[model samples]
Target: MPAPRPPTVPVLEVYSTFQGEGLRVGERQVFVRLARCDLRCAFCDTPESYPTPDNARVQRQPFGAKDEALPNPVALDVLLAAVERLDDPPGLHAAVSITGGEPLLHPHAVHALAVGARRLGLRVHVETGGHRPGAVAHVLEVVDEFSPDLKLASATGAPTPWDAHRETYHLLEGRRKALCVKAVVGAATPEAEVEAAAAFAVEHLPSAPLVLQPATPYGDGPAAPSASTLFRLHRAAGRAHPDVRVIPQVHRFLGLR
Candidate 1:
């Protein structure tokens, strides 16, 4: 019998762009945006990434050029080629950001991608919603960094469970240098939620930075949080975590996708 091929993942798009949020804000990196998400936050910017159509396709956009649609559930080799095509000198990017509607939803494929990227002399940054701690754990050994979102019910307009996020934070405790907990604060985001998220970070990942991203207005979602509201929320987060910082979506400000 032949060895079974590694299961492929549903990739939505692959491109090279500057990191827009969390600790890596402004850093140039290659983004491997995987498809599908379990949560539906009201402030979601890429709602299009949440659904997996019957004939889903992955868009390959090298160096921000025109996108070329490819078949979905792309193999590791194809994904690496997509990343390589985006690289000007190859292996020049600071990290390969494996982001998603929720990347952890496909842990095995994520692990394979991270391992492959590491072999290519690139750091792997797994950007996840932190809703699936088990999945996160499965790839923790292979991934170099984590950018976990701590969702809030007020912003998501849905129940944001705390257990999984708490567990994932616990797992990232010793990796303070590679861990950044991000919470999206919308115009209607409650100050209490911000404080709670900060407190949770302080309790589990005290050394890690906590980023409060003022939700960027997208789709028919609520407007971005006002400057005053952002300031207030920053103050609230600061009370619990010393490294709390308010950074909005830098790519949105810079007119980059």
Candidate 2:
């Protein structure tokens, strides 16, 4: 019998984009946007990532090159090659960010991709909705950084997954590289909830900084919080976490993807 074929992933797209949020804002990186999500956050900006696309659009070369449409369920090795292809003009990218509708949904593929990216001499970063401890545990060793969100009810339009978030944070304690805990604060976000999230972050993952990202107005989604609201949430967060900063979507400010 023939050997089993390598695993494939249902991908959305692969391209070069700047790290537009959290601690790594403004840093250029290759992005691997995987498809499908477990949660339907009301304020999610990339709702497009929520569905499994028919093809994964990949940029063949850097600097506004036309994207190549590869069939969905792209081969793991092919995905890695696409990532390597974007590294033209050597040393241009600082890292590779694995983002998604919820990247941890594909933990096995994530682990493999992280290993492949690391082998290419690039730092590997993964962003998640902050509620998948089981999946987080599977890819922890291969990943260098974690950007897990502390989902707020006011923002996500769903009950906060406190237990899962706590467990996930605990799993990331003493992490190999860095972790940035993010909470999206909307106009309706409560000070009490923000405080709770801050306390949770400091208590479980004290090493990681907490970032308060003001929700950007999206179609039927949460509206952007006012300057005063942002300041109030920052103060509330700082009560527990020493490092708390209010950052908006920088890529939107710079008109980047």
The number of the candidate with the highest lDDT is 2
**Per-residue lDDT for 1-257 in model 1, tens only?**
99997578888778778899887788879888889999888889888788764333433544344577676777778888777766668766888999988999999989988988888788899988887889977988899989888888878888877888888888877555346888888888878888878898889878678888887888767678998998888888888788988888899878887
Candidate 1's C-alpha runs over 4 A off are 1-6, 53-65, 174-178
Give Cα-based local distance difference scores for all models.
0.81, 0.90
- Give the worst 10-residue stretch by lDDT in candidate 2: 171-180
Q: Estimate each model's TM-score.
A: 0.92, 0.97
What is the C-alpha lDDT profile of model 2 across 1-257, one tens digit per residue?
99998799989999998889999998989999999999999988888888888899999976666899999899999999999989877568989999998999999999999999999888999999989999999999999999999999989999999999888888888673446889998999989999988998899888888899998888999989999899888998888889998888899998877
- Against the correct fold, how does model 2 do in TM-score? 0.97
lDDT of 1 at 100: 84
